[model samples]
Target: MKSILTMLGIAAALLAAWSARAAIYDAIQFGEPGSEKSHGLESDDSEVIRGGLDEPARILLPRAPASWQGGSVKFKLRVNPNRQNYVTLKLWGGDVNENLLILHADGRQVGYRSRGDIGLLDYGSPEPAVPGRFYYVTLPLPMSATYRRERVEFEIVSTGRIWEPGRTFEQYQKKMLTPSRGLYRFYVHDHSYFKPPAEDRQGARPEPVLPPQQPESFEALKERVNRELDRLLGPDGRFTNQMQLLMAAEAAGLEWSRACRNPEAVRRIVAGLDNCYLRWREDPSLASDDRSAVYPAWTGFGPAAEAVRLLHKDLGPYLDEELRGPDGQPVRRRKAWADMLEAGVRHLAASRSRHPKQSMIVDLNLYRNNRGLRLLDPSKGLPPEVVLGCLYESVGLEPWSGPLDGKGKPVLKSGGSDRLFTAKRLPKEFGYDGNDGELPALAAAIYQATRPEPGKPGDERILGVLREMIRARSFFRYPALNLAHNPVMRLETVIGWRDMQFPGDVTYVQRPESGASVLQAAAAVLEPYSTGIVQQMFGERQFFPSLDRQMEDREFRTTFGLLHVPEHYRLLTAQPASSSRLPMSEGQPDFVFSDEESGVLAVKYGSEILYASLYWRAPHAVNFLARIHHVTPVLERLATVRQEVEFQPSGRIFVRPGWTNSGVGAGGLNYPDNVRSIHAGETLPIARLPKTAGTGQENPLAGRGDFYKLLYGPYLFAMNASSREFTFTTPKNIVYKRLPDGGEIAGGTVLKVAPMSTVVLRRAR
Candidate 1:
């Protein structure tokens, strides 16, 4: 019995030892050394008195044990007169990674800091120190697998000055110099042994949840587009409501007229213009008011003037001969149009007179001329000198001001609008106000008006504006992922006028590259067409090849006009060198040509060629064959060899094949001269082999009926066959008959054709 009792006592002792191992560490209270349960010595500078307002104090802690791994360390601190100060507690130990965690006074986790491969710790939010309040802070000192037990020392510090918003840096420095008393009490406790209040744990709030987005359908997209178009183009359209909207509406109308050549579209165009004119007439203030006297007249006059000019220039031919005026008297369309134009010019002249020292035509004024609309005559209203001065002032050039200095540069003027145009400042200062289409349209209009006039002094300033406008279009920075609207407006304006001027005369400030915006690429390729620019476009399209199709087809149909020409021209890169190609670098022959007979459109840059089929194809669905040339220095070779179809209202159907090396550089169908309508049963071979290609490229026909057909009207039909092996052959059952005046013929025999070729069937008078 004695032996058993001794064994039991031994077991009891072991249990007690284990319990002590799990026991919580003793708490350390700040006071005189040995006054309380102080486990370690205090810093020499720290005062050891019970509790009173005093300076910052520090306390050291006994070495932590290795068995404390996976557990946390915690402490409590109290500050008198809770002031907003940065309260920091730093703990360091022998050869251990430094890890810091911050928490709000309310115990909400905010952030964490780790150093030297130490793991992350949840640092709660840093809350302002409240006077006379105690905060419980928990530090999760995670021990690495390689951690060795060692002594640790921690110090508490609280120091800061009062700060307020809107204080200058100097004031902040001065305020920081003024000190405030910082009194704090520090206490340490074993983290695992103590449990914080439940409310403290619940202080953190989760981030707010967001609702899911509703998916849009094709019909919904179509409906939305229609609604927006109606809102923008209707008789009560918002175009007349504001100057910006008015300009955008005008550009949209112009595009609509070009894309959809239907009666309803033309009528809408005319109606929109009529509304603008009527609105101007109703508001006599727009015509008679002194624009310079208005607060923002400097910005307002240019757009107002541009609106009047476009209304007259674009709407004059389409308007009805006569319309009832406000007094109920019949007014001729031309008379009303001229009246509005005169009023706008008079307003500009008056504004110029009011701001003699200031340039009436600022960069903003030019931006307001989006379509590059020119004055009907520079001789009328504002003279060339005043207009030129304004133009020069807009670009920071005083060509007429004084003779050239030592460097042949115009002498700088101290007081003038010319100071406003700097390379660094101009881009941010000017350009489209927003994604609105007005500014580009306005710029285009100004270019059209001020295009270089030969032998005219000060006309070069117009080119300066043109160059600046291009720079703005290409290089103006935009917010990330944001797009500029109607980027091609200026390009279209320049292309429309290219034929009237010398090829080398017009120069762009920047050469467009592969990474440019889609609209930018469209504009660049057509600007004195280069195969390189077109090839670059093909390369760039890889990034957002379908973005245009998705956004443009659904939301902004205005892009239709901008893309129409580029889409119709198909480039065939598969052909040999003789077919034409464009170089990747600069130095190329700049030429743009449309061969109606061959149905081939081409642009050349040096030895490289960018050519496409002129026949119409669905712009959205066309595909190109991509070939990889190099990987280290990336290069691509894209090719397209497809057939397309177009229909005419006069009972003619055109089928054109893409250009290939086997045929003439360009080839298409030939029509019979002065021939009346063909009989419904008549089949005629329309494609004639060029003398150059001769009979060498001829092949037998498969005579297949597989073809894609489009109907524009009851009489007009178009069909395209994709098979290269198929050929056209006259059917024996159908009869060929001719009719007078090109009347519609019912039956026509299938025409014979070579493999991989196109032909057009038409009844012409």
Candidate 2:
């Protein structure tokens, strides 16, 4: 037999041993990409992967640690063998010819497709009467030896058939015999787990001691990444979400190659990338324009061309470099790819869907997709300089999000507005229109690095705009992601998923592999794309409230947006130039970091954090939503509408009516109310907080953050975001030092807070 690792093209890792447990490991999960488990983890309880037997879905699974005992791989599949469709009798829509699905494990048949009927699907197994679903097609894998040797390939092949959603195996159980053909659909629940050897175990399991990560040489990392990229880009580029991954992988590699000045790596990236593009161009399923594929990404050529240009070299006149242009004549590879990308970006820049709250949903997505393209090569579509200039006029942050105006409307900032949006009154083909909602300051970070500096005499106007936007990020981005993420919001939205109760961890980990985090980490495939980063994102998904939250749950979900684009993961990595770094003062925030525009201030000094949302015009104190308004159905809002960790005027605490009140839940205890209410002018060191009965504040613990799930630093915040004045009384025993003008006060003192301004009181010695 071939070497197991060689066949799978994956290297195995050593892990610590432990006593047997039910789910010791789960290396691959259905439905979810980028959420694989090997040891110490398992896939969340999401629905299932609907890769029909025809288009078999493939996953580059993590190796099972040697310490793990042998276990059985259990699968719950929904099979439909018999189906009929009166809709279309043509070759593409006719009955399925697949009567049997032969599963191959370690290149050997696990199911008897050629022999006995017992191993055949539904041949002898008692299937449900109503084409429902059955649990457990248990395939046992006992770790015969401790060498970590195991089957590297496992496949269930039954793809070539009429896969219509309504049909089932039980409908024609008897006809699952030879030569039968019909429409059919099958589903494998994504939460499949590997059950350990015994239901009865001997003793308690030992604690796993994970080894410290050893850094690999660039050469070794490149080789490893190339192996995975080869599989993803080939055999055929028809696997689910392959286009986005293809684009991101190649673009990121090329970016890294350019940054490192390694033209050799650039060559390697383009070879596979070129082939993948051609394969898709030739594939009937994708090229015919039916567009039914689950993922909606197609811009695989943008980053490759940009890399070549940056490297200052011409892609040699190799005859093998094949690409057909719109005129049916051969053209430069850059021209062809650029042509298609321009079209896609054009449509995206003009998109106006708002019914399903597309603004909140697709806004970040559009920006994310644009990132992989990076908008660098101006050879095709809009001129690079022109595009940046227009984006300058179009993108804006207006109406400083602090207190309300005298007329009760939102106020404008002296510095600039708080939230960002595409500005009004532009000619066609300039400025996008989604809704009057959250735009991007990150765009400034993006353009700043990619474009030239603005302070020069000959510099274009766009550079000045980039400089302006970069500064604006300081004011708003702090509250943009976590403001509305409080206990009440968590119960209904983060946990309950804004009432979208998807099975298992579906809501939390929508597109595990696709997001800003994933894209940015593209260049880091050197260390990340394979290991800790992927799983860590999954772990953090349940709590984070940004685009990194993979919220694309359910089957037929189109990843054609953010998940489908290569992200911007190179934020903290090695810099290409001075522009690569944002100009914000990271080490200090004056004596007290304040932004009049956002009224969202912070003092992140050393390891300590002190944040305040002093004044917010909209009651947008806490929102699980990405935005407050929708464009199409004007004034339509999206929110988890829940109470917060508030400090009411009366100081009494509990669930505040109408998204009111403030409290904190950290380390699984409800301790936020300890701030209590002290009158505005009375500064107290120790606060007289309300008492928790009996067992004391039974609630989930989360360290640091307020109302928003994740813990951020603030000893005890003055938790009022309205235009009105409020006071914060510190808890007993803890004292705070007032900021800007330092003055120590006991924990029970009530610190007065002014509207539309920032205040900080540090924990005193």
What is the lDDT, from 0 to 100, of the residue 308 in candidate 1? 43
Q: Give the per-residue lDDT of model 1 (tens digit) for 305-416.
A: 4544544444556545777666678877545645654554444433432121234233335233322223433323433444555555544454223322322233445233
lDDT for each residue of candidate 2 in 1-765, tens digit (9 for 90 to 100): 123321121111100101111222223333333332221122211123232333212221212342111111223222111110000000111112333333333333332221111122222211111111111222211111112432233333331122222234322222222222221222221111212224212121123233233332234323433444444444443333334333333334343322134444345445544443455455523322215333233222333333333332323443236556434677556544444444444444444132112322222233333433433343334334433332333343222232222222223343232223322211111011111121222232234334322212322343343333323332221111112221100101111111111111211111123323333322222222222322333232422333324433322222222322222333323333222211112333434544433323444444233333322111211211111110010111111111123322222222211110121122122112132211112111111222332111321111011221111112333433335665655555766677756688885777666653445665665
In order of appearance, the predictions have TM-scores of 0.31, 0.33
| Candidate 1: worst-modelled 10 consecutive residues by lDDT | 623-632
| Model 2 ranges off by over 4 Å | 1-220, 229-339, 352-380, 383-386, 389-418, 421-755, 760-765
What range of 10 consecutive residues in model 2 has the weakest lDDT sum?
A: 83-92
Query: What C-alpha lDDT do the candidate models reach, one value each?
Result: 0.29, 0.28
> In candidate 1, residue 457 scores what lDDT?
31
RMSD of each: 33.8, 24.0
